[model samples]
Target: MSTQQPENTAPADRKVILVTGASSGIGAAIAARLVTEGHLVVAGARRTDRLRELATSTTEEAARSGGALEPVRLDVTDRADVAAFVQGARDRHGRVDVLINNAGVMPLSRLDSLLVDEWDRMIDVNVRGLLHGIAAALPVFTAQGSGHLVTVASIGAHEVVPTAAVYCGTKYAAWAITEGLRQEVDPSIRVTTISPGVVDSELAHTITEAGAAEAMRSYRAHAMGPDAIAAAVSYALAQPADIDVNEIVVRPARQR
Candidate 1:
């Protein structure tokens, strides 16, 4: 193995990373941390204003670390947009080393509440969105013979609780899909599923069920910050090429 650098190639350690749902919460934190670690981060989200602010902050810090951030307006539910986003990164950076499928929704409610729209939103964003990401990135990863797919699932994937039936179903589907991809793909292309527990994030804000919203308020009392999940993503990405960390579950110490 040679430690030689090619004349027209980026440093081996510098990776072109693409992250979805990056306007805030875990996605934003992941983008920031990746930039801090000297990786070029392409962040995608639906909120242009928040993405603009993140770009400004990332730019300021990038000036110090020589890393960069490219913010793009994205709606994960839009399959074409997701493909275009990944294509744009590949065009700009020559290759995308990693894709973080982090865009998700959590509109929890009891089945009796019959929030059918909310259920649709969760299915669209959490399940279909993840599939879109994989559809967009898998080809590129295969073409390059190497790439990483990191999914931000939830502890809901592993357990069922009151008021989270549909949300849990989505997470479970996400986990199963990610694991299935891992098992089916070439080993050189890594797949990692990160399941976080009770993180302090904007996900709770989307809950429409009055009772569920109130329950989340109490549930989030000791939740960990989004940065904790971001760190877990970093840990998975920093591993050697041959070492694939298949799954990670991160939770606050106080969470049951």
Candidate 2:
């Protein structure tokens, strides 16, 4: 077991990673996984209680690995909040090694359903939220000369399904935004998009449409656990600094 270091200093192998939407599901799994790998994980979300629970649950692992989990209240839709989130981490740790833009909402409904609010919610969280993260972290990475940006996009980014038109559009934007960042940034800054297929998560609980909700229930019957996607994130981060893994799509074998 390793003893914890001072707040301002991190070991050479330890990374300062910030994760958004970390209250539950994929975000929580990613934060826990990174912390166990000896990285300092700043987990942010709207649900402070769940965030605290996550920190409590990982206390022993973090202590043993010389990692630490810091839970902060965050609303990704607010640009200022996100900027402050990144700035706070840099202020505390001296540098932020990675930013995982994982906050997203999915309220599947047909175009004719006229669920404009749901559509807007998806755009705000999925599209604008990703942009907000990039906006906040790009400068930090540029100033530091190195950083990794990981987007937890959905497989919907690649293909559309019934009632997922708006959701898929937002995801496609996430994929495109991340791809554009990868092309524009210097090689010192790494970018990756993780597209997951039907992972067990709370995203579907947002679907108010009865039909879409019912359909998702059947579709998710063969879903993979959140840890599966966490493993993908770890794999991307584990690569050498010189190797930039552009994108990875992880789906359950049973998914068609």
Candidate 3:
């Protein structure tokens, strides 16, 4: 994996934050917002080219905010890769303050359509991916006695819709896992789940089913920008240590 250091060191109050699947959409927005907030953000994704583009786009703002954006090649589906990603940040920064498990895939299709491969793909990237993040970061957070784990889930966690049974199952799993972790972990380690609805993102593009794709086009017609979800993340992270923002659901006004 390729890694690049920032031009300037982070300020005293800056945090070392790790964001997975940060090449575009909600993950990219979160990484950019955190960097602008004076955080040393380690942005990782399978798309190294897009990661580099994100870093370049945020360079001036990061520099001005006493923050930095480091692009790293990463695949959340690989357990060893996630472990290395977390360890590499700890090795460089001495401590990792936060981890945003924003990696996910949504290929909406009905069960009868039997797109088994796409279903498995969702399970791999959505369910196992989240578990891998927890496995990699929980130990670090436990040892540090102070850390934050944020899961970018979906509004599907709360409701099921046509062509989204599998996707909603995966998201529900993400929400349950995050909630379970919150209950199990100590108070020193904060946990949060951000569920977004009908946001403009590349997730719909993954749908291989023609019917599902057509439906999503209409569903996303009134979608909000990815930055709105990023703002929710920022709000959760900005709260005082005593306050643990458990769950937040964000959706477009027109999205019922």
State how far residue 251 of model 1 sits from its true place (Å).
Answer: 0.2
State residue 94's C-alpha deviation in candidate 1, in Å.
0.5
In order, candidate lDDTs are 0.93, 0.95, 0.94
Task: For model 3, name the residue pairs that clash.
Answer: none
Q: How far is candidate 2 from the true structure (C-alpha RMSD, Å)?
A: 2.8
Give the TM-scores of the predictions, in the order they appear.
0.95, 0.96, 0.96
Candidate 1, residue 61: how far the Cα is off, in Å: 2.1
Q: Write the per-residue lDDT of candidate 3 for residues 1-256, one digit (tens) a residue.
A: 6556545655676889999999999999999999999999999999999999999999888877888899999999999999999999999989999999999999999899999999999999999999999999999999999999999999999999999999999999999999999999999999999999998989998998999999999999999999999999999998898899999999998987
lDDT of 2 by residue, 129-182 (tens): 999999999999999999999999999999999999999999999999999999
Model 1 RMSD, rounded to 1 decimal: 5.0
lDDT of 3: 0.94
Error of 2 at 82 (Å): 0.3
Error of 3 at 138 (Å): 0.5
* Candidate 1 lDDT for residue 137: 98
- Which is the better candidate, 1 or 3, if ranked by TM-score? 3
TM-score of structure candidate 1: 0.95
